[model samples]
Target chain A: MRRPGPLALTCCDPLAAVTNATARIILICSGKGGVGKTTLTANLGIALAQLGQRTVVLDADFGLRNLDLLLGLENRIIYTAQELLAGSCRLEQALVKHKQQPNLALMPAGNPRMLEWLTPEDMRTVANLVAERADYVLIDCPAGVEQGFKNAAAACHEAIVITTPEMSAVRDADRVIGLLNSQGIQPIQLVLNRVRPRMVANQEMMSVADVTDLLALPLLGLVVEDEQVIVSTNRGEPLTLNGNGSPAARAYHNVARRLRGEQVPLHDPTRERRGLRARLLNKLGMAGN
Target chain B: MALFEFLQRLLGRQKPSGTLAKERLQLVLAHDRSDLNPELLEQMRREILEVVQKYVEIDLEEGDVSLETEDRVTALVANLPIKRARPAALTAPSD
Candidate 1:
């Protein structure tokens, strides 16, 4: 539930000062499928909420919506974006607040049938309504540059393009960046996901430099490949929810902090790979080795 | 086998597959960004040759046009072999 307060009065808290301004509407997208777009969205949503900023994650991928499932709010959803837009329910009625994180809310977009009738204007209308109450509105965009993508991008002022280091993913991301540019979206950023450090060190997989040099976008963060991500996803809990100290979880937290105008340094893969052995030795009190 | 592999590495006789992947991605992205396929590039070469031949004689078979990408910027590079300049009378207007 949303609490009412003065819209213009500035607060002593810096986080509140940011929330006083209009919500930042950002779209998370990737032109290719199964490249961790949804995963990034769910994790980032939780990370932002943990930072004490009121956040709303809208699942704009109507054809194959899963943000709710990833957030473990599927069973709690009684009304969706469809009902809100149809005037059967209010925005508060459609929004499902997280059980663990009350600061975060999830708005599941209408089902696949709504794909036939929903337009870009309708998306904007819903986004506008959601923005009135949130400090940040993250739209989980669908894959590919189709109508769904357009509807998702239509309401966003900024974009975060997520991609793996593979050739196909990078090529598709480049295309999606071109589309976002044409739409006049500003300050687009990139996230490199599922990076295997050892493979990169052995020159078997694409290095961070290789992908960044070609994409030509400021990298927001790097998420190392971790098996715990699969385990967390199957349990319908995002990596950022629990303080597991997983590489991907830390990366998500760093990304959220950076988004709030903090200066967190990016992760280096080679150093992280070497640090594992050193950390193990330190834990065993064998630092001299 | 390990010694032989070490020797090959020391002598720089082996190429890493990452280098190959980077090279291939550069070539393909150049084409993809410029929206120019091999057939289109050939057409462009022929048109460029026709325009250049109006002022100078060029070898039609030896002319080539291709895309090159560096620092994320793509350029259309052409190499046209010149046989000789056209005669003044042919190049100049009749008036």
Candidate 2:
């Protein structure tokens, strides 16, 4: 059903020679929905690409796949992993390379109707094939600890569990971490998302400490709630793409750097908010004098 | 009332919502992670009481069995008040 063309493997050949190290197949997952799993996947992919890592983001959330839309590659998807697995298209044909960042490519999952036909073995096959050419394969896992999550976990060597500071999110993250542990996914890390520094300062919301204490995972990065994230999502452009220096964008970049074994310090939202307030107070005092 | 409230806020005497959240989460997660619901815990308490009653005179009303999580490790902590040792248990041969 597919043409055995030499052209399929030609595009990704340069990266294989660039790095001898095997690609890190990481799963980006959260047990609860609306906690920014896809958002993290999109931004992290762009960040890793900017760091010169040839990255392929595999959208494993077939039932409610929107990773293509988030990365702004929705219209360019001609073939998907389903077609590639079915031998209807080549790997290069199915991969939708980012127009802005050529280092990054997206393999969007097929329609929800095909969800029933997909299995964990199919996911591993796709991940292994993509891993052959890239330095990173990020599987955007679906919400919940269901079959979709199992399929995604089957393909990853490690995982990044994203969660908000809310009670429900943290509880769900703990459960997901337990599941990841049972799956033998080593060195699992946590990324606390949508942190509101002012709220935390006022004791209105959970602090990063409270979350980390409960989840008991190594803190990978902290993304303070930035309005720019929503704007960039609507534009289908990840915040890291513009290098806008937004809080969330910086956090994402730091995550990528840390993944590269760089010892970048995690962001402290509480201290950041206090620093901003102190600077404003000093300026106001000077103006009054 | 308003002045008192302002003074309380200025002195930070009021319990913050974040602390409440943390306390609540600790209690709930201990149960959630242990996979031991309240009903199951109650059943366990009854069964434990039945087993212990045969060897000791215990205060069932004051007995407590609950899951506690510390350092990411959940433990089933039970405190059963033993009123007295039964004559049979006291007279049983030493192992």
Candidate 3:
């Protein structure tokens, strides 16, 4: 129950440390639906692990949970958080390891029939284990500011809001931000997701500057709408893993590095897309040279 | 100033969708957060108008007060029109 340093915040800081552990918990939330919160969570968990931190992606969406489906670990989860909470399994017994990444793990949500309710103590217990076990914990929160949302958020040290470059998402994010502020949680950052770079260049979408001005929040990451995201989601895999060289994959990795406290350059959305010949010409070392 | 002109010169500029959408979205969230319906606001306006009308000729439309809902508030703002006081009593005092 201790507060963290302004920018020097970590998951298990003395301020929030129950027993002097060093794990950091991050809750990824959105105020409204269909704003890419789940996708952001999957990629973020993968990104943090890729950045060399021991990370766990906790699916707190319960009842209608889908993180396992997104991570392609649905067929692999024999037990879930609900099972662990209900004493049917131990915490480590339920974790589904990533197929290729050894450092990352996925704690999937239970099936609908399990019907195990999560008490406040259960949330605290799970959050404590996150602090004890991993370097970072990324919990994928459900949409809406409801019980499920509160359940997921109560376990985190800080929050990252995922909003689309649209009004509804930003508005919901604004509400979530206001709530976080009231709860005395500081260092809340914003992530603008699914941006169309071409539209920004053409003035059809909101520029990053415009969104920052209106939202008046700390900017974390800006992800473009890459076709690779669709292909990866369709194939039930994280685009950050095993996806071929694509802009979205690169962007996810860059965000991952930034989350680990690196200085990754922000994309200039207003730049027009170059033609293939122009891209080739630039790659041939004449554009900057 | 140079950047301002460059942005202005960018042709066919539409209203920033994110800003506008955020505006409309925040407007609704204030009410949603508090579970207050629009009809409740109307009822309060009418009741407030009735209470004031009993004292003086309170303007209804031009003397409107409003309630604005944002992410953190349901603020009541009154844009009241003051009635002129018959030209300052026409002679200061009838001394």
For model 3, the docking class works out as incorrect
Residue A169, candidate 1: how far off, in angstroms? Answer: 0.8
Q: Give candidate 1's chain B TM-score.
A: 0.66
- On TM-score, the leading prediction is 2
TM-scores of the candidates are: 0.84, 0.86, 0.72
**Highest-scoring model, DockQ:** 2
- Residue lDDT tens for model 3, B1-95: 14453344333243434335545654565565556578997788788876555444645669766556532556777765656434534454445
Off by over 4 Å in 2: A1-21, A272-289, B1-14, B53-61, B81-88, B93-95
- The Cα RMSD in angstroms, rounded to one decimal, for candidate 3 relative to the true structure is 9.6
RMSD of each: 7.7, 6.1, 9.6
Task: Score candidate 2 by DockQ.
Answer: 0.38
**Alpha carbon deviation, residue A17, candidate 1 (Å):** 15
| lDDT string, candidate 2, B10-77, tens digits | 45565456666888999988987888878999898789888788899999889888888876799988
Better of 2 and 3 by lDDT: 2
What fnat does each of the candidate structures reach? 0.42, 0.56, 0.21
DockQ of each: 0.30, 0.38, 0.14
Residue lDDT tens for model 2, A172-233: 89889889988899989999999988867655578888888888888999999999989998
Worst 10 residues of 1 chain A by lDDT: A1-10
| Sort order, TM-score high to low | 2, 1, 3
